[model samples]
Target: MSAQLPEITFDEYLNEQLINSLNLQTNVIQNLAQYSRHISFQLVDIKNDVEILANRVIALHQQQQSQFLPPLQMFVQPSIPPSNSLCFFPPAMQVFPPLHKPFFSTTPDLPNKPVPFSFSTIEP
Candidate 1:
């Protein structure tokens, strides 16, 4: 046997539609709130990771300074004309400064001899 459907008035039909629309709006707002909370949590985690990496870099820099190691500094050769008075090192050798002599020449054979490092200007 088929179930008989009840006939509703026009006003009741409009009310039902309004209620359904409100329910959909509520669901959208809840979903948006959940998404916002998830994004905030991820941002906090990223912030903490960046802070930890920054601290590690600072510690590494301190250790390098205490051991008389070369602090990472960019060595740029001036674009002036090459002369005997000017010292111009290539890009490969420019990274290490002459101050790191002891750490570099720690070999047994060269115990007494100091390694010669010259940054002579290239003739162009």
Candidate 2:
């Protein structure tokens, strides 16, 4: 013999559905609150990073400016390098080898010579 299930009333079914929906909404609200807190923490970290970077940039700029005055003298007399003697480029007094003519001449009247690549004079 088959056993029959008890029938639930319409009002009882509606109350059950409402309770389930309220539970779901409560869980969603709790999850949303947790996410908001996490985002707030991340924002705080980003703000701190930005502040630290700004301070470092300011310090570096000040250091560069303090040392810039010595280099101003080099402009007047290019023969004298900066106080540190670390030149950024070839000194004005250094002579560069003359640029060699290209092997292929556009004009027939000009003869071209092959130039060898040399770095004998440049110090490492």
Candidate 3:
């Protein structure tokens, strides 16, 4: 059997409408918060992947530069110009000084004077 209840007044109806509006607004705010959290998580994952890719790209660029760079070349023989050859006088003037032979030779021209040498000091 249905029980008789008192009719809701105009003030109570207005209050009920206000409460429903407030509940709907709260539900909307909660849904927006959940969506923002989901977006943040996705952004975090994307950031990590980007960082890894950036590091890999840097390593690859370094490797490429190393491979393309040329090694320092060293010459086996020293390449000296003809003018750099050692001489007592300048060749452009072409002046020849009188040659004086050394007083001593392999035959020992100063045998009587006796050339002082370390050979005499070295004991056999």
Best by lDDT: 1
Clashes of 3: 0
Cα deviation of 10 in candidate 2 (Å)?
1.2
lDDT of 3 by residue, 2-35 (tens): 9989999999999999999999999999999999
CA RMSD of all predictions: 15.5, 21.7, 30.8
Query: What is the C-alpha RMSD, rounded to one decimal, of candidate 1?
Result: 15.5
* Colliding pairs, model 1: none
**Which ten residues in a row are the worst by lDDT in model 1?**
111-120
Candidates 2 and 3 compared: the better one by TM-score is 2
* TM values, all candidates: 0.50, 0.53, 0.50
Cα lDDT for residue 97, model 1? 57
- The model with the greater lDDT, 1 or 3, is 1
lDDT of 1 by residue, 47-115 (tens): 777666755654554455567654435575545445875576655654535444433354232322223
Candidate 2 structure quality by residue, lDDT tens digits, 1-124: 9999999999999999999999999999999999999999998888777666655654554454455544223232355555776565556656444243323355232212322223343489
Ranking of all candidate structures by their TM-score, best first: 2, 3, 1
Residue-pair clashes per prediction, in order, are 0, 0, 0
Instruction: Give model 2's TM-score versus the native structure.
Output: 0.53
Model 3 lDDT-worst window of ten: 107-116
Model 2: residues with Cα > 4 Å off, grouped in runs: 70-124
Clash pairs detected, candidate 3: none
